[model samples]
Target chain A: MQPLRLGLARGWVTWRSVNTTREGLANTIIWNALPLVFLLIFRNATIPGTDISVGVSLLPGMLAMLVVFSVMGTAYYLAAEREDGTLLRAKAVPRGTAAYVVGLLTVAVLDVAAAVAIVLVPGLFIVPGVPLGDAGMWLGLVGYILLGLMACVPLGVLIGSVVRSPRVIGGLGFFGITGLAAISGLFYPIAVLWDWVQWVVQILPLYWLGLGMRSVFLPAEAAALESGGTWNTPLTIGILAAWAVIGFVLGPVLLRRMARRESGAAVAERRRQALQRV
Target chain B: MATTPAGPAIRVGDLRMNYGRHEVLRGVDLEIRRGEVVALLGPNGAGKTTTIEILEGFRTRSAGEVEVLGEDPEHGDERWRAELGVVLQSWRDHATWRVRELLAHLGAYYAPYATASHPRPHPVDDLIATVGLTASANTRVGALSGGQRRRLDVAIGIVGRPSLLFLDEPTAGFDPHARREFHELVHRLVDDDATTVLLTTHDLAEAEILADRILILAGGRIVADGTADALARQVAGRAEVRWRIGEEKFVRPTDDATAFVRDLLTGPDGAGVVDLEVRRTSLEDTYLEMIRRHEHGDAAAAALEPAVAS
Candidate 1:
């Protein structure tokens, strides 16, 4: 709960940075407008399960994917800011680092919240026969979303601490998270993979996030037809929590150490080395 | 926590900093009083910026005692940081933020600023005006010119109303007019607020314009420390008085040019000086001499001795 509260604070600060003025507001509108793109292209595609509309079938997965992408982007932006000294300057402020980190990760919180709102509302109202009304299922959805977002914070800090190039942030960020997600079954089922790949992905959290979302949103009949006919709810929650725990416990320590070691001079030296290499 | 004001505004004694085996700063001693604008003048890799960053609590010293605003900068906290301001060379781009609005947000971070009189959050307005950014106050940082951006950097640095400011090559990309204007603002800021300034610059003219005292660092040591004019005299030695007398141009060292001119010109008839120009040593000439002397020792002395005597 404390971790959630801290994450909430981070989310709120990112919101504040974005909403501080009209430009920020516009940026959010542009970012949140992503669902509109989904509506235009894949909104009418054939359903994945049963005879359900593709818009309805892909909605949950799209929501989960958007949340993951937004969360990862927030994490990477923070890493970039830290690399560029903005994070260090924020650390020098009164509350020290925890507050500042939460502030940067705040963007992801807004992203995930907007994504969840946009995903659920449309699936609930516009799409016919989209599942709802199971209290346990709703609980599962909230749990995974919250847990998934929590995991992003530490990963964001880790990526920020390790990646030094401001320009490479996008490449490193997309490749790292998307590559991990590809095997984890966030966008598609792991059952489509080779036996060796399935075994490998079973060890990842996104597989559980995707699995957890499917178990909650899909009709129980559809869920029952695949993957042992039961949601790995406990396993999904536990793995996500573990990632969050590792992120929380180690993230700050790593960030502080990285900040202490890195400086403007370090960046200049790295640039010199890069030039020499070239 | 103790606020008796006993220690200097900035102090670094025997400070040594290194990256790997390459020592950047070695045995550097520095002291800056409150309200004093001390300039660190040196060539690139001369450890000027390193010393300033260490004092600003942005960099850790490998060895030495550094007390900034009566606190150990290496172990400084938020309160210590609040007492000082730093103008970094550049800023990151935020696509949507206007300049004034951005400064206002940064000002809100300080504890003192959470008040009533600055109700609308116009703290940075005067600083914006101070740095000559009134026209660009509404401009986004992304849209600003290099000189304008640097000015905004200065405005942001001083927005906290800090008692001490660390400026690392503040006027680097500024034009001549902008640079001169910045110096005036600096002088006024120092006078009005007693804001202790520690500036690092490659430009000697900028140092001479803004610094009350200058420290020339080389090989991570303070090779010369004095007021700009004083440093020039101390390093490059006496002025040379040259006069065109008849066919030959005669050059002689003079401690008192007024008295020397009377003896050289009026003492003898037809030995009257035609083209007499008294030249004093410049900060640039002295700085080069000091840095060269620090590196080459006696070899430097041999070259500079005859040049100074003439």
Candidate 2:
């Protein structure tokens, strides 16, 4: 029952996230709001029937990209807590890992909620009826974004389990997200890419999320597939399910090993070496 | 007659912790019996924390045997964790919650509030008062003075009222007054709950006052484990009787101070014995001597120093 350990860790992480966002607001405001402007403003002089002219073709991919970028932030929080002594404290508390995962998931869900309000709804508003055509279509839009982010849980846990330093994880953050974004067709459709590029993107999980998300928003006339390049929503979801299960199974095992690390000795040695340098 | 309990409450026999080729705890063997507050005294990197963590079940040993509450800590469960309260020196360093909130929250993790023996959360006010942090109860941990934060750490450790408490450098940041108060609190807890305490401290004075027995560790092994008086007898055990005689202050270590004083005052060369002070070897001296002797590889030879010097 001792939920306090979990509560405390989750609360601290949430507070840190809010602080980080507030500190970086000047940059985030520009980066976050610009896509909305492009979607609505560029529609003034464009063709109605064609996908590229009205920004509809770009809508699904952009939203998929938004989900990916935002979920990456939560993963960063997990890695940060692991590096800091706070995670070590949690390891000693009762009902430890089970309680901790519950708390982390709570934050993940809330973070994804913020992503929906910030990215999905606003982007849906700009693209007219295509992204939010009816009740069913809007529901699908929400569901896929949630599903895609949920699918990313395993990769996030794997990263959090293996990484020990915040600086290295932070340094990798941009490349990790953007590299996946490039291959996933966040800015451009994978269908328009060269043969080798498409092959590379197809195998990555991001490509499936992008494709599944696009299926909900764009009309059937949007992209012509190369015979077997057919979009399967169930297959997209299945891969995510596999990833989530793998994470659920391996996260604890990896964390158990990491938790056994001699935290005090490590901290003491680092502090010792640091003093020696001084 | 009260028969003293025999077996040690905690027994670490040839315990070893290894990280590849680096051995942190090199076969540490120690025992703390019932009704004893044994202070584990050592310098940094002497495996004090590793030993404590292994006993608390936070770390597993690479070799040897350990038993806390008669169960191996590495395999100890929630039930065993509930039996022992650990006041880690750095448990709450990164916390931002209020002092009171942190203590109360951690207390919930262990209070088997409905036990057939003693039920209910260990009184929070009692713990807060014991650690002398009543005034800083509501203060955010971030805003707390270092001493106050340490008091809260102590409060959190005993929130569940465990039968045995493991306090690692509990009063490191406390002021002199607060440290005394904390020592009294340990005594009070022991009296009230019969809590067997095992504290580790660098402050020898603290060990003298709070510990019924002191266990000195060096190179990951206990070199001395005995009552203050027994340990004091390790080096220069006899009292040094000093007195002013005419223009000279004379000093001599004597086993029988009364007889020596009788002889001094009754002899024909009788002189005035003013400012007379009888001083026994202190706990600090014994502890230091033990460590010195252990490091010097002359345990048998060095053990002869106190008696001969006397």
Best by DockQ: 1
TM-score of chain A of 1: 0.77
Over 4 Å off, model 2: A1-63, A69-75, A121-127, A130-133, A191-200, A225-230, A262-278, B1-8, B19-26, B92-101, B111-113, B123-139, B238-280, B297-310
Give lDDT tens digits, candidate 2, residues B1-310.
0122355678888998887998777677888777678899876766888888888887768999998887788777766666677777664344445667666666666655338576645767777877778888876676777777776766766787776788989888678988987788788888887778999899998988998888777766766667777777755435678888778988887877778878977886465667878787677766666566656765444433433332
Over all chains combined, what TM-score does candidate 1 have?
0.84
Question: Which lDDT values do the candidates have, in the order given?
Answer: 0.69, 0.67
Worst 10 residues of 2 chain B by lDDT: B301-310
Total backbone collisions for each predicted model: 4, 1
Clashing pairs in 1: A10-A102, A10-A106, A11-A106, A79-A160
The residue-by-residue lDDT of candidate 1 on B1-310, one tens digit each, is 4333666788889999998999888788889888889998887887887887788777878999888888888777776666677876544534345788667656655644333532322357787887788898877666788877777777767777777888888888788988887788888888877778889998998888889999888877776778977777663446778988678888887777777777777676436678888877677777776666556644335333423432
Give per-residue CA lDDT, model 2, range A1-278, as digits (tens): 45655465655554444435544444455555656776887554444556344566566666676666544555665665654445655555555555565566666655555545665567656666463436777787778877776766555656676775555666686687678777666556566768887877766667777777767766665544322455677777887667667766786687667666636445445445545766
TM-score of each: 0.84, 0.80
Scored by TM-score, the top model is 1
